[model samples]
Target: MSFDYEKYIRPGKLPHIWCPGCGHGIVMKGLIRAMDALGMKKNNTAIVSGIGCASRLPGYIDCCTLHTTHGRAVAFATGIKMAKPEMQVLCVGGDGDGVAIGGNHFIHACRRNINITYLIMNNNIYGMTGGQFSPTTPTGAKASTTPYGNPDPPFDIAKLAIGAGATFVARGTAYHANQIEKLLVEAIRHKGFSVVEILDSCPTTYGRRNRFRSVVEMMNNLKEIAVSVQAAEHMSPEQMQGKVLTGVLYRDNRPEYVEEYQKVIEAAQDFAG
Candidate 1:
């Protein structure tokens, strides 16, 4: 597939640093395709990332990218959006960075309904920090730190985003490359806060010790488990158990953060003037 790489990719950054079979590359491809579909100007876009293997996305995209501190992409993105409302801001991070350390900011960002798209590449474990069991690591999954199987239940990121007031919420896996791109495009076009939880695979860290034959096998497993929203609607509780839902889970047209702030400013001005 020939894409206008010059338009969305930085020069000399070809061949990203991600390990072989790492789904971050596939996820980045989807993101670039979505940007192309949206016809968004690279100059007018900002991609922010927190510390993690998935945080390397901003470095590959030709935009106003910020590789911020651990679990702080939301705060950085919020500042970027507030400073330049006209710019389209996208936040990228891993499950641990966004849902664990950055959980507070993530919730607040959803509550604010800021015009930003957050892409969380969830590979189930903390890939960057040596495969520790993260907040999204499935219960009973074994990580380096959880050699005996994790005792804690993992977080449901999509539900959390929706409950926190995110206007648009979607889920896609790296294996479903085309669908991931489509969902990303929709998320970017949405006017309010949007979150797309991408099920990615970390072969070296999360896959090797988890009994996944290879990255390919893990991706195949994701395809097997993912179900579309349309399919989920008719699925019985027994049938839906342990299945991950792909596609848009929820969406709503809500007043954006900046727009609401503007309204408050106007009202205060009217009272004072």
Candidate 2:
């Protein structure tokens, strides 16, 4: 049976603004499925996002959504999560919005290990903003701003999330649509801060500039280069070269920011009494 996506999407929001062949649509479908599987209540969930193609996801979803300023998704989501710890606050954004201008906020949110989930769509380019090279743009990749190819090294999103102290970190590619939902499900179920990086494709910008020939080729490349974490463990280091690891790369159980903050509040209340 086909899933009822309309139930989750806002009415009359169809004919989305995303360009044809963009992977953002696929990513959104995966999220909808994950939310359905988890029985997420739309009224009790707050979807927050910064400016970008991926961030626009919250606008189309039938939920309490916030389309905030550029690169401040995490910061705003943090405040929402703290103010209403009972709500499931999920932050969404693209590479530029989440890791470039929002880099400081991203890492600090991870450090706090707050009860919020961040879903970052790493298309490697700023698809919505002039096709500029983003923080995750691979060195030598072509973008509108990098006519001669990008000189800066790309960030390993999963590694950054783990290094920054996020309690849960996972990776999925748009090619593996099913895996995206699974990763998101696990991320949401985790207690503390969770980061799921979805390697999406911006066929209009990144693909056209990099000579991928077609969107299919770009998506095929993603499939060919991804290795599941379990499979990667059995492969030699040399064999794993040029291949990105998929699935949950890191997870830890620790004190969540909200619960810990409540302790301070309790102590203050006792002193006052």
Full-model lDDT for every candidate: 0.92, 0.93
Checking candidate 2 for backbone clashes, the offending pairs are none
Per-candidate clashes, comma-separated = 0, 0
How close is each model in CA RMSD to the real structure? 1.2, 0.8
Superposed model 1: Cα runs more than 4 Å off: none
Number of the predicted model whose lDDT against the real structure is largest: 2
Q: Which ten residues in a row have the lowest lDDT in candidate 2?
A: 126-135
The list of candidate 2 runs beyond 4 A from truth reads none
**Candidate 2 lDDT, 1-273, residue by residue in tens:** 889999899999888899988899999999999999999999999999999899899989999999999999989988888888999999998999998899999999999999899999999999887699999999999998999999999999889989999999999999999999999999999999999999989889999999899999999999999999999989999999899999999999999999999999999999999
Deviation in Å, model 2, residue 119 alpha carbon: 0.4
Task: Summarize candidate 1's per-residue lDDT along 1-273 as a digit string, tens digits.
Answer: 678757788899978878898899889889988999889888999999999989988998899999999999999999989888999999999999999999999999999999999999999988877899999999898999999999999899999999999999999998899998999999999999999999989889988988999877988989999999999989999998889999999999889998898898899999999
State which candidate has the highest TM-score.
2
* Residue pairs with backbone overlap in model 1: none
Error of model 1, residue 269, in angstroms = 2.5
